[model samples]
Target: MDGPGHGDAALSAPTLTAREAGLVGCRQCTRVCEAADERCPRCGARLSSRDPGALQRVWAWWLAGALLFIPANTYPMLITSTVGRASEATIVGGVIELLHYGSYGVAGIVFFASVMIPVGKFVAIAYLAILVQRGHRTKPKHLLHLFEFVEWIGRWSMIDVFVVAILVALVQFDLIATINPGIAAVCFALSVVFTMLSALSFDSRAIWDRIKTLSND
Candidate 1:
């Protein structure tokens, strides 16, 4: 008799893909249609089984985000003026200042949202891009989950920028006290936006496609 794992392939049925079923998915609206479809009737979007340049676009935006992130961290995010004194704080410097003031909760929140999350996103995006590009044997479902996570967290990275904007708006006393957003705030915002675009431009479907090709080979 065969062992438990010996007949697993025979026990599991083959999964049918949309392409295999003579269907094409609209990239914009995500509506499935006949393989013969040249355009989506509902949204007038061009139909393709896969994007030829998806990875290229992903890498392009990812590079842009990474480049901007450097200046975002190096330059001061906020400039504070009080009477005759003025000071500037970068993102990490501001977090450290918060920690010094015993605002542990706020420091932790800001550090997590601004620092950890953005760095995690950078790593996650690059990992996914490399995996899909190389057609590695990793499970497609896992890659999809990572992609979804990257998408979900894209907006939250802007928390630091939002805080700076609020401070710039509310703290104004002409000379007694004033807060203004620095170059880092703009750079950080643009970095977040670019990373969000990088994640969006990636085609998650490529994960399945790469795995399928590997399986066939």
Candidate 2:
């Protein structure tokens, strides 16, 4: 009566993947197609069971983003000129200055958007890449969720850059007071763009494929 239908036994069974079922999914449209199909009918996208170059591209972009991020933190993000005197502020410096002025809420927002989020994304993407490379011993579903989270938050990391651009455009007052974006702005923007490319280049199906390979062994 309580044989194969047992709770733990059933739960421990490996999840079946589309690849195992001889299916390929369109990355753009999420349409399931026969593995033999060259393209997805719904989206006209090339169909592949797994992206052969996904990890390579992910690491390449991730490295470019990480390298640029170092200079982004070290250099000034915004240069402010007031009464012909110039003062530069980096990302962390801006947050500290905000807090110094008792703008606690704004400071927190800036810190989260500029500091914590980017670091979190870097760590998350690297972890996902490592997991996939190591054959994904962890739950593929969880890995996929983490990848999705990284992708979702990737765009928001540019909040600081956007803020700098807005301030630079609106605060120009020639000699009295002017705000200009600094070198760090360019670095940070490029870093954000590269990291976004890293996330986009990742193939979530690779996670499932690795999981299936492990289960078969």
Best by TM-score: 1
Give the worst 10-residue stretch by lDDT in candidate 1.
5-14
How do the residues 73-153 of candidate 2 rate in per-residue lDDT, one tens digit apiece? Answer: 999999999997999999999999999999999999999988898899999999999888888678766887888889999
- Inter-residue clash pairs, candidate 2: none
lDDT of prediction 1: 0.91
User: Can you write out model 1's per-residue Cα lDDT over 100-217, one digit (the tens) per residue?
Assistant: 9999999999999999988999999999999999888997778898899989988998999999989999999997999988999989999999999999999888888888889899
Question: TM-score, each model?
Answer: 0.89, 0.88
Each prediction's Cα lDDT score?
Answer: 0.91, 0.89
List candidate 2 stretches off by more than 4 Å: 1-16
Each candidate: RMSD to true structure?
5.2, 4.7
